[model samples]
Target: MSTAVHDHPHGHDDHAHHPSGLARYLTTTNHKDIGTMYLWFSFAMFLTGGVMALVIRAELFQPGLQVVNPDFFNQMTTLHGLIMVFGAIMPAFVGFANWQIPMMIGAPDMAFPRLNNWSFWLLPPAALLLVTSLFVPGGAAAAGWTLYPPLTVQMGMGMDLAIFAVHILGMSSILGSINIITTLLNMRAPGMTLMKMPLFCWTWLITAYLLLAAMPVLAGAVTMILTDRHFGTHFFNPAGGGDPVLFQHIFWFFGHPEVYIIAIPAFGVISQVIPAFSRKPLFGYTSMVYATASIAILSFIVWAHHMYTTGMPVQAQLFFMYATSLIAVPTGVKVFNWVATMWKGSLSFETPMLFAIGFLFLFTIGGFTGLVLAIVPIDIQLHDTYYVVAHFHYVMVAGALFAAFAGVYFWIPKWTGRMYDETLGKWHFWLSFIFFNMAFFVQHFLGLAGMPRRIPDYALQFADFNMVSSIGAFGFGLAQLLFLYVVVKCIRSGEQAPAKAWEGADTLEWTHLPSPAPYHSFETPPMVK
Candidate 1:
């Protein structure tokens, strides 16, 4: 993708309305449009996935499967994980990359424009297949997102649908990675060296590499499972000399890094937003870069941490335990940098800043819990419990999802040239923060009290906390409506934003672009210095 912004009537002149048509979306490969598509699509998937979460929470509300059948609840859980991971969070970050990277780096478009279009178009059908699975005779795969065998083998058409969807989603992600890598490497404007790229770009570059390496592994793992389910292979079937544990080895080999692939850019977003709101250059820029790369490298070796309870040998257990624990060091460095950047700076808590702070506090709580879970003995007690679920929700939702919202609020002026209602944004932030923690925090106690995960019903002893969690879930769900309203209101009408929306912002993006960036950007590279 070229990085130059060109003069155009629609993107440049805010008054000019562009045509809305299939062709406009289909034929054009503009990074902004594609980025918009990804954001909107991911938002749609979020609602879809969120509904599934509601179903899960509702079913577990009173522990008697009130709203849905046990089978459907299982399906909801499985689909919810799949959609949130692939359809929501992954695409949202890619959307951010598409919208921001070129602008930040002074590029015109992605490196491979047509391929970008192809990558996005692939998602809808794949998403449709996933949604469509619930209606199939055997219902959506109840095997959970992990798709471990025996149970997975029993799932009928839904499993096949899921496998096929995985193929398409994987292809889309890989192609998207290729486009990103190409753009960052080959399309950066003159004087924009690799080290000079923004933290978001750096994190994404590493994420894309992780995606490239791990997505193929996922593809292969799923394909093998598909063959095992249909073609009489025993890749994970003990009856035929294949081992289920082997399946885990391969899956986690991909799955663990896949966690960071979704998260590292979130770290980048938090890094970007903190400095802007804090009015300080990011502290430890080089340390942040090295920390992210270190995380990516360590992610490969720590896959077995998820499987410590599967009776791995003692040495294997110790290795994964220690390897996984080491990640906390780099992650801690990142947290310290963010806090240090804010120390004694001219910090005003804007909505974006509020969310960034929320991410730090809540994500740190999750990280501490993760360290506990990383210990082999504790993992034995907590594996596959609501405790584990709570941990990741903090990391993914409070961490990744919160950071995603911050990125949106921080850049909305650039995207829409309108300031969102600040009062409403703050309302959305506080309400979301309170309700989100309300929903997931107590789940830790529930997990500690011997409640297993993925079950629709629980014993009477677990009722009180579960009720609290359910109420919190509904509240959190309602709060997102406010988010939708805030975003839509900004898009429709708000105070006009200036060329540089935030005072402390320093990316090439703010320097080169107007409020609401041009459809074609940077016809000529601006001098960086």
Candidate 2:
């Protein structure tokens, strides 16, 4: 509504009156502070989940349940999936949105800043409930992260803890989503219309809506389980005249879109990194926007693809199979655009670009395997095997996690006002890339050999690959410590970075801001044109 840019002649130091120490984090509504907290919290959860994964890999190392009992092993698998998906990946992206979105769009802060604070604070207690559940009487929910009904109904008090945790996490997601959507829609600077905004902003706008729509479905699914367990309701009980298949329908309805909720933002990160490093404007910005929208829409109809082995009518199976495969079309458009952006441009291989490239190569492999799994016949074969496990890790680990690493490496200089050690950054990327492949690639073979997932012990024929995978898992986990070190070292004492750290970058945050962006950025709205 206002096309005027206010000037602050007194400069940054004159307006500094924010609180200090723990009180600042507890009681402030600053987007940057909340974002920093989100990033650190996500990293903590990532490490916690990584430890659980190592336990699973170690137990499966030689296939005898040597390290833990079968029951405990199941709990590790369940908790690892839940923490990584909800705690690690989702919050990490939200952190990036908090830090980057307002600045990118030239807004002073999120539209609902106090709600942003509340959204972030909600995560820790929910995460604590999840971690504490593992120690409660009878251990955490072990029916797997999908939390299917009948198995869920039979579990102990820990299951109740997990249900409550899900409710809290869902609330966090929904609130965060609403904040993001409101800020993007209402807070863009004058002259910066939606089409001219950066691709990252566009992706988050879509992702936030996806969260709003999908999280409620998850909340509903879990609530039914809570009622079935204690209130004698039969939402998923056959003897109570309900259908178990109904639970799968509802859970996967949320579950499948949940995959993109984690990934679409990753796509946004990669979209930004590729162009910044390539010294090019994005090749097809409009098409990229439309393709992302198409993928989100398609995510809803393809949920049943995860349930192919659960027995559906032939016609139902055919409809889902075709819908699932059709997703690749828009996904391919995105991939083609990334490669085209890099086509003969003056590309520099910075740490961020390295991770972005890794994301492209590995995420494509994941997508291809996904395409293979989309065929009803093939999915029926691979549904519960390690092949399914390998497929998603490629998508989630390489797709979301790798893109997150790219975003951090790309933007950390801005956040900290110092350059990271390139040597160590490269080391972190290469080690993670190598070990990641080592850990998951072999699982495809193990699955083809009929090695089942979620089991502590495997047949003797699966021994060698499992051991190799275990070694790789340990390596991948250790690589992340290098990442943590690099980030902290940068903050403490790395070289100073220029105001615009990357030469090829063109966004407003890069073009208009100083390094270590001021405590309050864009206190005066930036003119977009």
Candidate 3:
């Protein structure tokens, strides 16, 4: 059940690379090229979302609104969450899956290569719809990222545009899921059995299925909103015999799993990166697999935790509360497995490892906060406060975003055929780690102190912490420019990388493939022993 792929290199002509330029990108089916596109697109959107975040932070810098009004501030909040979640983080992982999966599994390319191309292409128009909606008449959906109703139902053309964008994104996710699932199931090398595959693949396998199952529910939720808004229906409209609370049920059903959709992949990256730097096989690999599956199974039952404030019956609230707490068990199993992997191994503090460690520390805080929020009495006090905001950023920004930076540092050498400046990489890590904490950590105090989220202005006492957060937010945003420079320098010309850049890296990409993986990763099935 434990195995690794052993791919054989082919003749030089087999490296017949794809054509260069805009034309090639427009029509190419090469997964590496496509993966590059996804990463770049995600980065672009990351900046877009980050800017929106700064606008939010700046407005809140003082008790009184300084820059924007409440309505526009809500727009920034709405678009920021949507862009970061769908446009930045999700695609970034898909980029990794596109680049890593076939290579790791010892297959030539994705099973449905053309479908892969279409799936990636679908993102731009979707992102455009979201971003450009700002210039529209009603000025985007001010109804927060959740798109809760009555508010959403009354919003303008921008809302419809957002709905269409969600539909397209859902379609894109479905198509990408199908490609990933089909490739993993049918195209894996002869000996790469399910249990033998890398933890990253397993996480993605679960994540793809999560997407397949969860995305349609979101599609249905949004579709109902669209119909209710434009058509004669009142699914969430009280006047039309609709129940708005029902929308929360549907949305959270999709939304809760969406949290894992992002985190699971981040967990996958941490799994790979931690073991590599620690020079150890992942501890509890088998348990990690089972724990992942368990978490996925538990995700469905816990959706209603978000609805605790809606005045559902105590029995229903208790069901969701306990169910929510149960997910932490498997999640903790993952955390324990990671820590055990690094317990006494030959650890190195490379940029990737630094980011991985940061992820572990901050993500745990995020989880603890999540558990705190899971309690009915506590959540009733803290729900929708800056405390909730602090919790998720710790999860999404520290947890998922840090993991992403770790992955990029870990693999940039292989992807680009060059090693990045180690000093710059380290600088990037330290700066990001420091500035990130500055920005969001105080928000916890703000939340505990009762500052609400999505508001442009706040009460007098919250001013100092808001200023600190704004400064930290700006610093955090600036640190990413260094990350961008580091990656660009690597691609343009850093140091030439060897076949195995990291001596401890043991996967097929490191052990078998050259520094830059060949255009056709597996011309024939690799004999991985």
Candidate 4:
């Protein structure tokens, strides 16, 4: 009744191969395997999306169109955004949840294993639809990833496929959220009170709640798009008594929160890494949890910020501008807390900590630009331009992706019981850091100078910066092969690792369990006392 499964003994016969059928995954509820699947699938999607980015960069390497036309360029951006957000970043974090959460909480598995598996399996089909649409007649969706109507309405079969794919992916996210909330709420190990839980779990709990609330709204909005396309409703079409602006309102209602949904987990990952490498307890853990919750609450109200360019009245614009700015306060608190956690602590710059420090500086730069964009006046000039493009990529690629890689490197030893090559890791970090900045930093000037986003070609003045960015892009892309090598080498054969992989690390995970956890881990509950 307590939902604590510690010492739940079973004979060897209790272990049998789980049934292998489509139904096994369609209805799976296991946490570890589901988490593993999510992470690997996300890595694959990252590569796929990266390839799309490479195509974009290759075309832009010169002054004119080369690899793709404007239409195909549009498709590449749309699909790239979709895959990286839903397919890569989101799934990677969820995968981390599957592997780490139960272990941290001392639970045998997630609250609902079948639901866990179901959430992961649903993703493949959804991803397939989005990818395969490129080969379909009239090609994949070319309406920008936002799928802003009028343009979206003009799209062909690919739009329909993307719409359905969104629905499927949303369903998957909603289900995963439910499982995470249930597990955290119901399955904490004895003595692990809510306050005692790590920031990673706390941040995830708030994120899951946001997902539960916002994904449904996205599903509903896309449902309307589907109806408009096939069933003749005018929810987003102004010519038919509906408002195109209404579509943006509805989409951003979901879209704004979705940004935090991807980011908050990265914050959690950094929270874990900073403390581990800095040799101290996380500073202000309670405040961090409350701050995350506050961010989620604020996310819902700020949806209109993305819609300021859509001709909202002055009152709406002013209200949204101020409300969006409020987010900076809570975000500021989180940033301050991380630095404080590291203050005066004996720190070693491990691979994980290196990325965390990188995240701190880069994410702050990103947050500052976000505040700049939050102002109605600044946004009026910057919106829909490369400045906006530069801003979000700084946050997403530099902020989120960097933290994710840090988390992966920090935990790889525990997961595989082998230490990765540190020299190789250093190579991966420096190359990525320098080139990522090189690729994106100059774009701020281009955007300010009035270069628009999503264009396959640009004016002569923009040529030099675009060429530099493209070269940096290739450098960043090729550098990831180092990451792939490090992971594979560790998994295959590397230096043996200990149970408490890092000297400064303190968690329920380090207190118990061996490296390279057995295939059938936690069949009996782990004792937390």
Candidate 5:
């Protein structure tokens, strides 16, 4: 690899001057600025969702209703799921894509800069609609985040608000996906082939396509809910000759693919971080790409697994069960590849690597539980139980959130040109890792004991684990402040970082760019060979 810097024939001076302060963020089309906004906004939503989780935990701290009423409890559960999935996890990954994708592939910027800005700006308003709906005539949507028809139709104006929020979120996701797909397909450097691109870029390309395919199904489902509520439509009203189960079909069609949308990108982050820390080229790179694509394709077929209890025919149930369980094969390949990448290599326990290892360990637990749920009889027994809740948080929090933290720690040095306090970073990781398990792991036991989810209160037998889970939830919530502190402290006054922050980091961003990548990176695309 060469260590030379090349200037483009058309340079930064030809580009318009970027505005400073508020104007910079509000009017900028710069990918870095837009990426920063996406990150901050997602963190805000993470805190909001975390608070809702605490409220639910607080009410469930003891047997019998103690704090919120059942309706409000339902609202808390619904909003917590919606906000965390749409606002926090999805956008955080998009933020990473915006900041790293262009640099990784040696592109000047996202394919559509103004559309990128519009996509980010759409989020806050949608989030506001969701939060403010709690104050509306009947409170926020109490139907689970799935927004099933009958319960959704029974809700007040808040359901409408939630419906609209989903629409806006879908639009933003579609637009963002378009930008990512276009950028990856059209803007690589002179000689960088698709196979030569970093794993992170490859993951985002697949995720962007998943978003495009899935968001419309969600949008259509919500639109039907809206019509059933206001217009004289019976799309889901059984009394009006519509089947409520149809809503499940549509929602899961979008919902199941959504699981991979969140997890695959996290897989990408771990794929990058593990090899860098272990000082090895990624094991089975071609196979990893094929495995990721296979997972995405399989996602569409396996969605009916979520509907096993909705009473499909035995043959359909068996097919779904088998298809759902088969996802493990590719997912297993990814996990094995990461472990093999680190096997007997010169490994370091940097904060990033720690979180990658945590993602691997915890996400596998989530995956195994998913396999258990895929068995039709087992799902019939455990559907809508705390077991389901426990399973997803393991995947979402440990899988996506842990990987996001790893990406942040791994790349923040390059983003900010400063080293974060290693001591604080490690502390943040351990506290989060321990408390995250503490909070959700026990729910698996509670579910096996037959504790139902989405209820305000539970029977006495489930009391102890719920208490432990609540305490863990609070600890997990508070530990995030330490992450905030580390990010801020690094931005403000940490030691300066070098061009290639990690010795094993070999991508274009690390090898070809300076610390704190220039505002106009790849003003001229670098030669890849």
Candidate 6:
């Protein structure tokens, strides 16, 4: 596979022959170049969305609206959801795919590199459409990120912009899925079979298929809303022979799978980061694979659990309750396998491992809350309340965002050829962990007290808890700046990283390639066995 290691550290000067500056990014089809752009773009969106969240939190801090008005608050919530889900979290994981997939599988680049370039280029314009909607006469789509029925129909051109953004984003996602599927199936090196692929690759492969199946459904849902808003169709408007429940059905059909589309990649990241720090092979690898596929398959049937309060028949409620409950089994399997991998092994609390263990702890909490909400009666009590909000943040922040943190810390050495500040890295993790809990943990109380979500103001009874949550929210948001510093410091002036930075990193990227991989990676595909 490799005769000797080359010292290709830090600056990728091997390709002075390659284009530089803005030209390198705009027109280049190289996987790593495109990957870097995707990451930077995602971080920019994360900050953009984080600001919206802070605005929402600030308003909720007091009984009367102190920061933004009711309408503005809705805009913040709506834009925050759209930006985080579509613009921040999803793109971060796709950045990982663009960077890691080719290297892990010993392919020179993605099978469809030009398509990769085009897919990433689609995001910024979509983001522009979303953010710019705020300045429009109607002040963005206030019907919430779900773009739910009658409100969307009544909204102004802002809703149309949001709809068009969704369309562009969906097209980007569809193209990405096709590229990933083809690359995985048709481009593995001589001996790297499907079963032998890294768990991250396996997870992404499944996620790609989920994207392929679900994106069009979301596109259709939003398109119908667009027609209702503009062309006077009644797909979801009751006055014109339509049912609003139809929107929920179609949205959740795509939406529930979207949860796992974010999660399963996280599952893959934890799978890798945990075992490497534990100095053990991942426990029950085969079963982990099957479990992941099971989760993806189960995601389809459980969409109705989210709709139970909308007056589905009791039988349908029971069916969804049971179906949603069944997902916990495979999820529990993945968690069990991760914990088992760390049992009695040489564990180290590197920043990556700290983030992984945090993911294990909090994501489990989210999963438990998810189970609690799966019960029909319990969900009826908590619907549209802060409890649902708390549960979702735990899942998305811990499940996907924490795992993304771990992956960045784990692989930044490879990507940048320099070591991150260990001290600052730990600080980043601890600050994030403590403040995140402080911000969100109290929201559970607010929800149980019957405070509804998506509101600008709350009753005085929810006051003290909301204040604490806001303070914590501010702290948590500030902690991310430390993360940014750690990464930038590593890249600009940190110590040089060796080829194998982690003692137990066993993937082809670590074992067969040098640090800060060469521009033309795998000029000759490394044989697996």
Measured by TM-score, the strongest candidate is 2
* The 10-residue segment with the lowest total lDDT in model 1: 8-17
Model 2: how far residue 515 lies from native, Å = 0.5
lDDT of 4 by residue, 30-146 (tens): 665677678889999999999999899888888788888889999999999999999999999999888888878877788888778778889999999999999999999988878
- TM-score for all models, in order of appearance: 0.97, 0.99, 0.98, 0.96, 0.98, 0.97
The TM-score measured for candidate 2 stands at 0.99
- Which candidate has the top score in lDDT? 2
* lDDT score at residue 242, model 5, on the 0-100 scale: 96
TM-score head-to-head 1 vs 2, winner: 2
Q: What order do candidates take by lDDT, descending?
A: 2, 5, 6, 3, 1, 4
> Per-residue lDDT tens digits of candidate 2, residues 399-493?
99999999999999898889999999999999999999999999999998999999999899999999999999999999999999999999999
Instruction: Write candidate 5's Cα lDDT for 150-265 as tens digits.
Output: 89988899999999999999999999999999999988887888999899999999999999999999999999988898998999998999999999999999999999999999
Predicted candidate 3: what Cα RMSD to the true structure? Answer: 2.3
In TM-score terms, candidate 1 sits at 0.97
lDDT of 6 by residue, 1-529 (tens): 4422345433223553578889988998998988888899999999999999999998888899678889989989999999999999999999999999999998878999999999999999999999999999989999889888888888888899999999999999999999999999977877898999999999999999999999999999999998887787999988899999999999999999999999999999999899999999999999999999999999999999888889999999999999999999999999999999999989999999999999999999999999999999999999999999999999999789999999999999999988999999999999999999999999999999999999898888999999999999999999999999998999999899999999988999899888888777875677788
Misplaced by over 4 Å in model 1 are 1-19
Which of 1 and 4 is the better model by lDDT? 1
> Per-residue CA lDDT of candidate 3, range 335-383, in tens?
9999999999999999999999999999999999999999999999999
Off by over 4 Å in 4: 1-29, 522-529
Clashing pairs in 4: 6-525, 28-113, 28-114, 29-113, 29-114, 30-113
Return the lDDT, model 3, position 503: 69
The parts of candidate 3 lying over 4 Å away from their true place are 1-14
Instruction: Write down the lDDT of every candidate, Cα atoms only.
Output: 0.92, 0.94, 0.92, 0.87, 0.93, 0.93
